[model samples]
Target chain A: MPRIDGPIAFRGGGFAPSDRTWAAVATLVGVVALWQAGASAGVIPTLFLPAPVSIARALWALTVSGELWKNLSVSLMRLAVGWIVGTVFGIGLGLAVGLWSVLRSPGMALVSALFPIPKIALVPLFIIWFGIGEGSKLVTLAFGVFFPTVIATAGGVDNVPRGLIRMGQSFGLSHTAIIRKIVLPAALPAILSGFRVTSSIAIVLLVAAEMIGAERGIGAFVLSAGNLYDTDNLLAGIVVLSVLGLLVSWVIGRLERALLGWR
Target chain B: MTDGLRLTVDGVGHRYGGLQVLHGISLTAEPGEVMVLVGPSGCGKSTLLGIMGGMLAPSEGAVRCAGDVPPDCLNALTYVFQDFSLLPWRTVAGNVALVLEDRLSRTACAARVAEVLALTGLTDFATAWPRQLSGGMRQRVGIARALAVRPACLLLDEPLSALDAQTRDLLLEEFASLITAAGTTTVYVTHNLAEAVRLGHQIVVLSRRPGQVRDVVRVDRPLAERRAADPDLMALEQRLWRMIRDDAAVAERERIDASD
Candidate 1:
């Protein structure tokens, strides 16, 4: 095996060679400067569009008063509860549908139909069914996250090399053992990718649920601030939501890297 | 303990999606013998090996193991995959340890894994992940995993075809040494004449598609005594080539014709 290869491996980092990290930063700074200038010049009403500086001030005020921390913790607690509920059932269902042919078809049909209907669309129905309480919010959150897990698990199992399964057979392992040993390990990367997608799903569902009926969540705060035309607080809430989504995704990514070490 | 476990394949026939791949093929592997399956591409040598390994079901015929292989076939067989199907998530030792996890006591299991790791020249690789190792090392891990099961019969599915010639030869010697020490009944599949000549006790040559038993040649000398230029080995290689070259040519032509 003489070396004849060029670029056998891609170098991983903050950005690839063709990336636009600097351009993105420049655009962010330009948008902030322009928005602040427009508001100060009275081109846009402060009540309609608070300047980036005022949003920053609101963020600092909330940060110092510890209101952000308290509300952020409450939102995160809801997220954790909802995610755990969804993840456990989703992973169990995924592994089940992935392994058994009898259960896969109708199971996936139900999931495909239910996964894409806006979780918010079900909010009113869930409110009628479970009342305007935690049950409705949780039901919405779980539904949003479960679909990706099922898709991931099935796709992972579907394309597993038949050779690997036969390899297990030669070891005198039973059919069940082959799935537990060979199939699961081989299917993990895809399953993990599915989990990654659902983290975003969890956040989107959480925000939507909060906006519909919640009193203490970031989404509720944004809605209330819009009702009062409090632009600084509304912009601040969006910033907090963005930050929360990023943090949640970052945590899932870290866990994925740690567990799926070979990848 | 000294009794031979003879595998008798009687009138085994099988087909895949209307295309018959094996036709009443029969062969035997005696206990502690290294039986090599050889023939050109699409000759069903692999399919035969699969049937023997119980990875595939033959439409007709049974794999009869007479001695040493537990009367219960599932308890006595192990396989080494060509792709070295080691679990990427598990370390080399972990892959080998999986076979013994339920059966052996932990202390003894650890020792057995350590011993096989050393036997396969994979001691330093016990903690290494599969992706971190080279092709040869991964195959060694596969061999170690099979051996760790303390199986009476070992199945090899073209285990060295993915490796470089040098690595293949080196590993071939290593496999011979390990099997000789263990005295396991082994069935190795490969199309390479040099591998068959170097390591096989009995070389079973198969015919192209709808495979049948074309010839069975016995190598009388010990693998250690059979040198590279041995006249018997060379003559056997020539005979084996004559049996397979035309078939290989036909298979190759079919591929080109299919593509065109």
Candidate 2:
């Protein structure tokens, strides 16, 4: 085994862990500097677009007002509920199609036709059926994410090497046993990719559904602020959305590494 | 080992599209014996091994497993594939554990995995992924997978063919010793005559594609009868080669003449 003499750090980053930490700090400052310049030079309008400082002030005020957390919690709840339901159905449908050729062609046809229809287009119909509450929002987001996850997962399952499954069965593994142990593990990397992709889709849909109709959520807050012509608060919501996206993507990356630890 | 295992191939044949890949191939691997199938490339030797392993069903006839192990266990018959069929997703230990997953209990599985990992000198590498290993280590993992199963009979589909000469010798030495320790009834398929000579208790030579059993060339000589100095094994090699190479020439001529 190779000895871990030191930390695995990037080339020419120096030996200090603090150097890496300081670099991140510098990057954030640079972004704030760029935003300040853009706002001051009128590349961004003062009334409609807040400077970095003003957006931060808006964020601080929103936090103090408890509006940011309330909105964030609602949006996150919708995303989680939608993503889970979507992923469960997607994986189940994917396996059904992959295991049977008769299912494969019909299943693919369904995905192709249904996948392209803009999910948000159903909002008015959803509003009519379920009212402008969590139900409609969750269903819309779930519908948006499910097909892509199903398609990706099914492709992964279909492409699992026949030799491994045969190995499992030759040892007298029952059909269900083979699926639970061998097939799932074999398809994990691809399935993880499906979940990752679906979560992002869920995030996008969550924001859209909120913007369409909701009392509190980053999206709804931004949209309402726009109606009230509170541009700085609207920009503050945009910043919040971008930060959430970055965090989600980073966390997903870490989860991928941990799940594929064997690989 | 329950008198070893016997393979009774009764006139098995297979056709693909308009072409026959194997036809009327018949041979018997007796108990406590090593039957080496030797032929040139594309000679249907591998296809025949596939039939014996039940990876491929014969289009015309059935493969019978007599003595120990059920006929369907022929389906259970595992092969050390010609290409070293090690799964890239599994670690060295995981690949080795694959075959034994059913036979052993959870604790036994872990213990057996540890045993084989040490036996294969993969103890330090139990956590290392298959893709991280060298070709030699990957092939060792393949061998370990077969061994871990503790199958009634073993199949080797020219596993060492992809290896270099030096590594091949070292591996062959280890393989022979290891299988001898386990006392497996093995069917080894190889194009290399020296490997067949070194490993087989009995060598079965095959003709080209749509292969038939040309002859069963027996190496009655014990491991001790193999004289390192006399080039005596060279005689066995030549004998096996003559039987296979001529058939190969005839098969190629028939192919060219057919193409014309």
Instruction: Point out where model 1 deviates above 4 Å.
Output: A1-34, A37-44, A64-66, A174-177, B1-4, B69-75, B258-260
Write the residue-wise lDDT of candidate 1 on A134-208 in tens digits.
888887788777778788888898878887776666666677778887888788888878877888888887888
Candidate 2: residue pairs that collide:
none
lDDT digits (tens) for residues B1-260 of candidate 1: 35446777888999898989889888889888889998768878888877887778898888877786543233476888888887778899988887777667899889989998988889997899888999999999998888777778888889999999899888988887887887778899997898898889999888777788888988878866777778988888888899889988988886678789
Per residue, candidate 2 scores C-alpha lDDT tens digits across A6-81 of 7788677656654487789999999889879999898978886679888889999999999899999988888888
Model 1's C-alpha root-mean-square deviation from the true structure amounts to 4.8
Task: Give interface RMSD for all predictions.
Answer: 1.7, 3.1
Question: What's the TM-score of chain A alone for every prediction?
Answer: 0.85, 0.85
- Name the candidate that leads on TM-score: 1
Q: What is the TM-score of each candidate against the true structure?
A: 0.91, 0.88
The DockQ scores of all candidates, in the order shown, are 0.62, 0.27
DockQ of candidate model 2: 0.27
Count of backbone clashes for each model? Answer: 0, 0
